[model samples]
Target: MTISCNPKLIACHDCDLLQSLPDGEQRRGKACCARCGAVLHRYSRDSIDRSLALALTGLVLFLVSNLLPFLALNAQGRIQDSSLLSSSLILWQEGNTFLGMLVFATTFLFPLSSLLAILYLLLPLRLGQRPRFSIHVFRYLQSTEPWGMLEIFMLATLVAVVKLGDIATVIAGPAMYAFALLILVLAALSASLDPQLIWRRLDPRCNH
Candidate 1:
């Protein structure tokens, strides 16, 4: 029942001296090493509120990323553009069903599920109620997070754009950059968030 991989309440990163943190811990505000002034945990001031806003923003961006065309390429006076979902469908139509399904699940499903899970976990915590689906949401987020392929998708798109530039005129779509930034932000959000914090806020009785 390890709630965190980081066990030391306060530790000097340079010297490796672990100090036991005093509770209240300034209401879980911040813990610093007394010996070296190294920060251990800097608690977020408005975790629930900020997480909720980010989750909602992520949802909207996820929708836009799937709905709008990613990019347009014009070759020999013929133009082609595709949304994220459309690209998957195109792959399937071209007899690459496995790759299509992989792309769809990685680029769309996993990331969206992660965002929704964060929302599900945080929303109820904000209202001072235990989240009913806390465990399910945590499991969903943890399982789906690794499958998010937005960064890989961006890299692939870049390679395609560079290679296609020799044969066609390439125009980037609004959704393309937005989607990339969205992925980056979501990744940051996921990394910054602590499940223990959310769980504690949700259910104080749960063993950490």
Candidate 2:
């Protein structure tokens, strides 16, 4: 989504104060809420460039989070470490196929797809080419938004730790910590994205 900075009608996201976009060369593209410091529209000066960097980082972290052991437990000198995939497999083995599929879809599939879709949208746009599947990819990301389920995964992790505490000592692994933070950053970035801005840039005549 793309936006042409309208200097005449800026509204504060927090306080709802209406004002004008700032005047002068220095304030040309800067956006700030009129009554509060809240940002209404924001873009990295080189948005496509930054999005690619973030997408690559997110991809690597995602791989580590899924492939490496997510957590570890030690009891009576016996140790166990399991990855996210391992957990899903365990769930399936325990006669919880439906639940296993739920975990797989929400925790792994949707979030990864969203990140990849964002990359597909931004990378091409950054390179001065139109996004190959801009609208469709954006729609997929939007649909997957509610199903990302990182918070649910964290809650389940906590529950597992508590349940296992009586039988074992748990040690959080690097992958566990990384996945938690990656979920947070990904959620933040997705929330901050304004599709209207991209659409405007993509089509000058579309009213958003």
Candidate 3:
């Protein structure tokens, strides 16, 4: 007789307790740790496909958000429209170089990098192929998520709009809507992603 250990074992990140995961189909709800009540996993159906779609959508929206005018101000019969890149550049030209770069990184660079990284990781996985530097790309995605700041930037933009409305006629632009949608889509994508699943798929033993 031969004894075999279950291959679906997972160790809790919080408590480091080793346990076996249920079959994929059985994990409809969140799996919790027996020792510490930590959430071990939340199985999302077709997560890679969903995340890929969202990442692609977010990329398009991101482009529109950067290219089009975010807002237009009509004051004293003069109109001025500001795009994201122009705004950052204006800040830089005004000698707020540090603030400008910070805005650029948080608003534009990090979010774009995250979307590209997601696509790089998920697209290959969806096609039943492995991406090069998969672990590094996934880790980059995780680290960049905190710095995306689209939601925070949008909130600040809304506040500015309200304040400026009293002084000038403020018109919201198409880019604003695209940016808002991008934020929601990115949030959903993040939620839909299962790091454990990706890690498992990336494992050579599991792949074989």
Candidate 4:
């Protein structure tokens, strides 16, 4: 059957083949492209609700990760604790302005913006109200999603701890755990979000 030019229609990213989405019942199974076997889309169960919950949880964890001590170092009878924001400021104060700003943007600003954007879009929809500029906002979220570098930052933190372990005692802080959890939560939030479903809900023209 021919697929209508509706929201339910999708183009395969791999082969650029256009295809219609299966019905709700057929969607319960895997939906693959007929020409290339590339997966088109899988209906995310409770896409909106799951994304909303994950985004809220991610926001809380993001706050905790930035506000609390990320790690503590003890050497020569002196202890130093560093939070995420403090680390960025320290970098800036050390004259590494570009690096500092990059760290702050990738680690702090982008991630926070992503979470907030998710909430901003999903909250109104959850309440049965359409948000203004939602299409633009959602596009912004998609574009900036790649810039969130929490997982990379976490890896760098662990490496720093390892390299410093030879000369000092490294103690994991509450924020470290929270940061780790935030990474996972943000990943889940991204996965749970269905852009097609969101766009369809936001624009009634998709239904026609």
Candidate 5:
């Protein structure tokens, strides 16, 4: 763990109140706005190595989720399977252009972008080297985190499977499991990630 020797002052995003951190060693915690009780930010000392591992794993699962079959629908003894990209293409071909684009963006593109961005930002930091555009990439992650809807997509998939089971046999494909695991990995990545550690590595003077 990196040692922080001095206290720092930060402005609350909620109330715009400036507050000082306790004088001494820094530790894992959540800072809240004194006036509004809104959460200002969080601090933690989680390992960088673990985050890198999760990023790599999520990337692999993402690939498998896209390349392999996601689901197989068997109706009247006819089996039809679809991969992630193919599903989007099918939707586009069927003239659901807007929804196709939405699914592609939220489920595939945004999620992949997030994983790649994580690797890009964390890989160099893990090697004890400073990465270019570190601040921009980190800010991008913060801004775009809500855009990636892996969990929402997974829930929709489960609902579709359950509903389709009454009329047709829905075989859970390899990609389904991979995507599910990818969701879990990404969630773990988000939780295990230490904002304090990332900012500390990115900038020595950074306090939040």
Candidate 6:
């Protein structure tokens, strides 16, 4: 889960003991619970810049993935192409509205919005300016992070390509590669983003 929150007393999920983190920020390290000794938080330098670069790249790849042909099929010498958006729309046209909406929300809507939201919050901060509703938007992002289910979408697409290959000539499209890279970018963005670090930058009075 990716988030940017101001937390003073973090409760250990395993033991439910609320505790404070240690003083001094390092380039890379994890704070652990004193009782159960579980990992509390991780701190790293240049997290904002790293996350910003990855998010910007992700937004570009996401647009490419949705615009270009996602995949193509050649059956009986008849060629057909489909984009990521088309796939979801096809599901809707085929009376699978629920699944279509789910795919659209999880794959297209959630991921795009997440990247945009990150940019919205981070860009101003990067320029040494505080964005409007910093805390509110940051907190809201945390709720929507889990809904970006691109990994699941990728897994399903892989299975589909394999199964379809047995019948049709599955031609991987440019968007397919873009989508693959987009997934990796988003994954790295999540890991590189440090919630605590952002909280400190956003609010100096944090944990004070």
TM-scores, one per candidate: 0.75, 0.72, 0.87, 0.89, 0.85, 0.87
Model 6 clash number: 0
* lDDT per residue (tens digit) for residues 25-93 in model 2: 333344777567786665444445655677777888898888777888999999998887777688889
Question: Whole-model lDDT, candidate 6?
Answer: 0.85
lDDT of 4 by residue, 1-208 (tens): 4345455688888998877777753355457998999867666788899999999999999898888888899998899988888878899999999999998899889989988999999999998888899888898998998898989988898899999999999999999899999889977877778887787787755432
lDDT of 5: 0.81
How many clashes in each candidate? 0, 8, 0, 0, 0, 0
- What Cα-based lDDT does every candidate model obtain? 0.74, 0.74, 0.87, 0.85, 0.81, 0.85
Per-residue alpha-carbon lDDT of model 5 for 1-208, expressed as tens digits?
2333333666777778877655324655676778888866555454577888999999999999988999999999999998878767878889999988987888888888888988998898887787889889888887888989989888988899999999999998999899999989999888767765677678756533
> Which consecutive 10 residues in model 2 have the weakest lDDT in total?
21-30
Whose lDDT is higher: candidate 3's or candidate 6's?
Answer: 3
**Predicted model with the maximum lDDT:** 3
| lDDT (10s digit) by residue, model 3, range 77-182 | 9999898777678898999999899889988899999899989998999988999998889888877778988899989899999999899999989998998999
Q: Which residues of candidate 4, in runs, are more than 4 Å off?
A: 1-4, 24-39, 204-208
Q: After best superposition, candidate 4 residue 173: deviation in angstroms?
A: 1.2
- Residue 87 in candidate 3 has what lDDT? 66
Show where candidate 6 strays beyond 4 Å: 1-9, 27-29, 34-38, 204-208
Off by over 4 Å in 5: 1-7, 22-26, 204-208
Comparing candidate 5 with candidate 6, which one achieves the higher TM-score?
6
Higher-ranked by lDDT: 1 or 5: 5
Off by over 4 Å in 1: 1-45, 204-208
> For residues 1-208, could you state the per-residue lDDT of candidate 6 as single tens digits?
2222425567887898867666635546778889988878877668889999999999999999998999999999999999988878999999999999988998888888888889998898888887888888888788888888998889989999999988999999999999999989988898888876677677845432
- Candidate 2: where is the Cα deviation over 4 Å? 1-50, 204-208
